[model samples]
Target: MSFFGELGNPHFRSFEGDIPDNREESIDVEGEGREVVPDATILYTAASFTDRGQVLVEPTGPVLGKAEDAPIDVVGITEGSRVLQINPQETGAEIVVIDIHHTTAQGEEREIAGTASITVGDDGVPTLGSSEPVEQLSTSIAIRGAGAQVAADDHIYLQYSLYEAETGELIDTTWPASPILLDLEGTMEGLQTGIAEAPVGSRLLIQIPAHQAQGTDDLIAIVDILAVHEDEDVDDDMESEPTSTSEPTELSSTEGE
Candidate 1:
């Protein structure tokens, strides 16, 4: 989603700053001899319309929150001006945006102002931060589940969140639903190495260097090893399945159908 900087070139201009708090700006539009503003065929920014579209926005002051720009995608335009209700999609968890108060290296924890204490709810994605780049791999246990130590033969269920270690911006997560299931041998080397010695139910906060990360970017993850099963069913399924052989099998023309 983008914002508009100017009212004339609605889509062309980039808008920034906080949205007006008091009320939404409304401009007047008449279907008289005035030229029609073109209807937008492509995605327009928040409340922006083309010259061919007769769109009007009322005059309003900055009453919105500290954010100066609107977070929405304007996808439609019409000949007549009307109120457009733009709903911003919540793409990630509700996280407290924090700026580094000072310059420091990774693993350095200091107080940040204007930041709130966040509680990662059940099914909620957790957030983490670092001052600078992660020089080496590190791990901190966030939660220790009750169970035996994880083993290579175990099938592990996990809920994890990966973030950019340098910026602390969240990249991905498996929580609130849809967890990851894997055997130690099938998982990534970084994950396998990090969780190898940890016990089942252990929530690890791991900081990984770019070399160890999947995308070659400094990363940090909060991983919850939910459960570990013996996975005998996997072995059984493999054994029951027929293996491909060099022998050719005859097929009918309508075999697929």
Candidate 2:
């Protein structure tokens, strides 16, 4: 990813004044992208693609509210193009793209806008990420259930979305697919506590903090329990996602961890 000084660098740019009110688009909590053309140096932005496959960057701007190019110091880089940047001045957090450029023999300049996006289900990117390390397990119930309680040893049937805490993108999900049946005997503490905290028919959002995430980043699981039983007495035709030979959630192997 070389730097580019070209006016059309898609990830970032600057405006002498406010971006045209008609052209600007507000970034949602998820992220945003906009198309823009200057009086001369026309440029467009908005839209994201996965980089190395470990993270997802929600594009937050084409109009960053103001123009500032203060260099954001590099904090870290993962195994690939993903870079972690930090601005010493917290107030400088207003996101903007840094145009790195080097002229080519043919007078072409290459640039990496630093903007990234991911649709999840990539190599290891999850549907959700923490953007920062998760320090502790956090659980929130999306939908509460009034059914039977999930015991410490219950074999439960559920659908879930799993995310790696590092890059904060979705890695796996059971939506539109068969639910998983888990024998909670040897699952991780985060999984055990989080699931036990919820009842059958509830949707639980659990954030497995870094410390409990084994050797990987934090694991975030959004579980939707469909049923619970004392044993694996599920209908014979029931196929489970956790143990599915096709695309298994890595958590399946973490039962004893």
Top TM-score prediction, candidate number: 2
C-alpha TM-scores of all predictions: 0.42, 0.42
Stretches off by above 4 angstroms in model 1 are 1-119, 122-125, 129-132, 234-257
Per-residue lDDT of 1-257 in model 2, one digit per residue for the tens?
21222221334222233223232222211111111112111011222222222212333211111111112221121111212122122222223232211000111122212222222353322234233455677666645665567887776666577777667677777653344556665566687777885656566667787555555678777676655533222222111112221324455435355
Worst 10 residues of 1 by lDDT: 95-104
Model 1 backbone overlap count: 31
lDDT of model 1 at position 131: 36
